[model samples]
Target: MSGLNDRILGLGLLVLAVAYGWVAQQWPEPFGGSEGLGPETFPTILSVVLVIGSLYLMVKPDADAQWPWGKTALELLVAVIVLVIYALLLEPLGFVISTTLVVGTLSWRMGASPGKAFLTGLISAVVVFGLFNYGLSLSLPAGLLEIN
Candidate 1:
């Protein structure tokens, strides 16, 4: 049963990888000519890695694998829901706020104290936001935090 599940998952991921790669290739070329690293570079690289990983999973699945049940499964579902909500709210709430909410909730779900979890999330979100916005010159949306 586990092997069968692995095969199915691998097949699905393989399809997703192909689609991802195709979509990455369809991205418009940046203005002022293409530099060494374009917007599609990371997604293309990720797609390649996913293709390799999915192929390996299809070829050799762990027989001892077990699926989550009851509370564990519910927790996983909650995590997914939180991530979906985070994605939806990111543009409006800003990366810092949305990321903090998602990360804090997930950390608390994993048994961390509420204060510690929220603090960790805030620190992580701010650090990453600074890295991308300042260090990398990639502007993440400031949304509610936007300054005129």
Candidate 2:
């Protein structure tokens, strides 16, 4: 069962790599330089590496490997739900509130203490906001916290 799952995942990765590679190759390179590679070059190379890694996994799957399919699926489902909720509430709740809630929930789901989770979430949100808005001078929507 595990071997079959591994093979399936490996094949899926290979397919994804091929599809991404094709798309990357089709991307227009308007900023072509005389010596340096264009933007598409990195993606093309990454896709090739993904394909190679997947192929290697297919050929040499670990015998002792165990796939926690149920746990992984539940985690993924929860993550998707959290992301959706965050996106829906982002504008009304504001970046700080939405980000903190999402991060804390995710951290709790990942087995962190509630206090630690909340603290970390708060700190992370502030740091990210500072980096993007102040450090990088990126214009992020202030949402509900917009000061007149």
Candidate 3:
């Protein structure tokens, strides 16, 4: 039963991986002859990783795996909801704020204290924002925090 479930999940994920890789390939050529990694690089890499992982799952699944129940299932649902809301809010609230909200909520739900969770989220969001915006030259949406 678990093997069948794993195979089904793997097949679904494999389809998603292929689609994601294809979409990544559709990105327009970067301005400067593609000297550095472009927007598609990360997604392509992620899709490849997902494909490998899905294949592994399909090939060898855990025989004793059990599905989440009750509170565990509810927690998973909440996590998914948080991720969806985060995506919707990203452009409006900006990367830092949206990431903070999502990360803090998940951290708190995972048993961290509210204060610690929020602080961690804030620090992490800031660090990631700085890294992507400055170091990687990838501009995350500033939205409400726009400097202009």
What's the candidate order when arranged by decreasing TM-score?
3, 1, 2
Off by over 4 Å in 2: 1-68
What is candidate 2's CA lDDT for residue 124?
92
Worst 10 residues of 3 by lDDT: 33-42
Estimated TM-score for each candidate: 0.89, 0.56, 0.95
- Give the candidate number with the greatest lDDT: 3
lDDT of 2 by residue, 1-148 (tens): 5466667779999999999999988866555433345546667889999999999878887667775589898898999999999999988877887898999999999999999998899899888878767765544557777898
How does each model score on lDDT? 0.91, 0.82, 0.93
Stretches > 4 Å off in candidate 3: none
Q: Please give the ranking of all candidate structures by lDDT, highest first, separated by commas.
A: 3, 1, 2
Model 3 lDDT, residue 82, Cα: 97
Every candidate's CA RMSD: 1.8, 5.6, 1.2
- Candidate 2 or 3, higher TM-score? 3
Model 1 misplaced regions, further than 4 Å: none
Q: Higher-TM-score candidate among 1 and 2?
A: 1
Error of 1 at 84 (Å): 1.0
lDDT (Cα, tens digit) per residue for candidate 3, span 1-148: 6688889889999999999999999989888787477788778999999999999989998788899999999999999999999999999999999999999999999999999999999999999999888887778999799987
